[model samples]
Target: MENKSKPKYKLILDAAVEVIAENGYHHSQVSKIAKKAGVADGTIYLYFKNKEDILVSLFEEKMGQFVSKIKDEIEQIDEADQKLYKLIEMHFQQLSEDPDLAIVTQLELRQSNKRLRLKINEVLKGYLTLMDDILHEGMKDGTFQDQLNVKLVRQVLFGTLDEVVTNWVMKEQRYNLVKQAKEVHYLIYNGLRKHN
Candidate 1:
């Protein structure tokens, strides 16, 4: 059996993120990433199949952790209303802390082909499912509007966050993104919550 926990795998992944984020995906070369990882060029092949594999794997690895962390945080909140806030808080906080990952996720990743975009969307379903779970719980508990179109609400919530973070990333990360969490929460909360 192969050891999947090798530190070099993570090093290569991290280096790929930085290299791709700095140079658009089309411009990022395997040798560049390998050098950045401080490993031989041939070593990258031991972990990933090719450049496309690295890009897809990067999304899976990073977004997998992102979803897992947010899920853990959301599970701890008793009220559905508070869970929504925690969800938003963790999303912003995670990307804010890792600017390179943010750039890769928000900007570089989108530059791939339609087929790749579809694969990325498949990975995104995990986060979307988490939001659906929250919205359903909120409705059940009367925290959010009972008549809310669950699908639309989920898109609205995720779409708003996507836009805000993309804007922040495009602007060169000049402002504090996590600080916008409370404001964003209130905006979405007022729209979805029953009492308003």
Candidate 2:
């Protein structure tokens, strides 16, 4: 297997995202990804076991970076509310910047089988954990209601963002997605905020 740190691995993953987005995962072939990556078809197998592995690895690598970037950006801010806003903004901004990724993640990936979906969910846990941390921080700082249910709030937060992106993708990204981040943040923030 090729070392994942190699530039070729990223090239394969990025090409996979574009290919899968263009042709649904079931329709996308290893040769297609290899060609896009400018590598031999055999080289794909050096980094992934199969198409399923590629899909799972793609999610793992992309979501890992997504969560890390958001975590780093939010860490610089002190307030939980602003952190939440930044989280929403970054989520939208990143997806909007990479429309192919948005299509693969939001639409194409959902067509996978039960097992693949579960594997994708495993990769999603890191992102969920980031959201959980933000929620817990808000509660601890008295910015959010102490009585808030962290788990439920986390699901709601993720669901809201996921739905927004899915809608944007489904609509062919006609409108500006990042612009809606503020309203999303406002809805989620008000739901969890402590009321006088």
Candidate 3:
């Protein structure tokens, strides 16, 4: 027999994403998600404790895999520039390929209250750590300025890519996000002025 439990859980999660995206976190109801999932409301509780659990688990499930894959990729590359470019490209490519997840991740997930937001932050530390590693590697090899604040640089890198993705999502995902990765990396690492 098939492992029916797994699919049910995924269905509920997918429905939650849709409902939350359509209604915003404050207005999303378990009943709404249940209807979308084609399951009874009680079924959600079988897999998740509550709405907050649903959001937390959703992020953990998706981002855990994302961070793991990137970590593996970075391990295979020694050059900081290559690692950074790969990170940015993979991030945008993943979102661009799946518009549903992109919407859920870029917009709906952030609508949670302050407490839930803190939990999400805790989960995001892994991705930030990956950025820090790249910046540290660049500094060690003299590819980047050693005087740069690693923390600030990490924030800038992540913040800029996040803004770019958000703009793409907001614009109905009509543009090519991956195509901009080269320009983004150049601006962050080399700046725009012609070399003397």
Candidate 4:
């Protein structure tokens, strides 16, 4: 009788996160990941075509859910402020909920080589476009300041959230990230909202 091969892609990814987190991206090896996954070295190649595929798949699987949740929140809310607040809250909440993903994204993933970095950037653009829509809606409704640069403001907003989450993750996940949502939103809104 032939033995069936289990689906090990997810196992490999979870193992990859631990390996990458412990060793850093440059130092992580496929053999190490396979061993951690409890599979033979060649098994990883069957699931992921290569190392880059693994990284990109990991980003897509993780961030895809993130983008979808935020998109759903955006659909339910009418006010831009509410949407922005929800975005920050959910963003921090997700990171806090999954420390492994936080470590992978905040630490190991950024260590990808230049070409892979560009690919990761491409995946990130989809998330940023969601932010851009919120900014655009705010401007259209006269809620946001007229002089705000849409693209730059989006960068600042994402950058701030990114830094906040990274700090919380790197600090041994001791911080209350979701609780800071209001303050972070207030800081961003104070800069972008129109003066009365």
RMSD of each: 1.4, 0.8, 3.4, 3.4
lDDT of 4 at 192: 88
Enumerate residue pairs that collide in model 1: none
Enumerate residue pairs that collide in model 4. none
How would you encode candidate 2's per-residue C-alpha lDDT over 39-115 as one tens digit per residue? 99998999999999999999999999999999999989999999999999999999999999999999988899999
Report residue 71 deviation for candidate 1 (angstroms).
0.9
lDDT of 4 by residue, 22-140 (tens): 78777788899899999999888778877777778778777888999889877999999889999999999988887877888998887778899898898898899999999999999
TM-score of each: 0.96, 0.98, 0.88, 0.90
Each model's total of backbone clashes: 0, 0, 0, 0
Q: Which residue ranges in model 4 land beyond 4 Å of their true spot?
A: 1-7
Query: Quick one: ranking by lDDT, best first?
Result: 2, 1, 4, 3
TM-score of 4: 0.90
lDDT of 3 by residue, 103-175 (tens): 8788987777889889999999999999998888888887777777888888889899999999999999888
Candidate 1 has its poorest 10 consecutive residues by lDDT at: 1-10
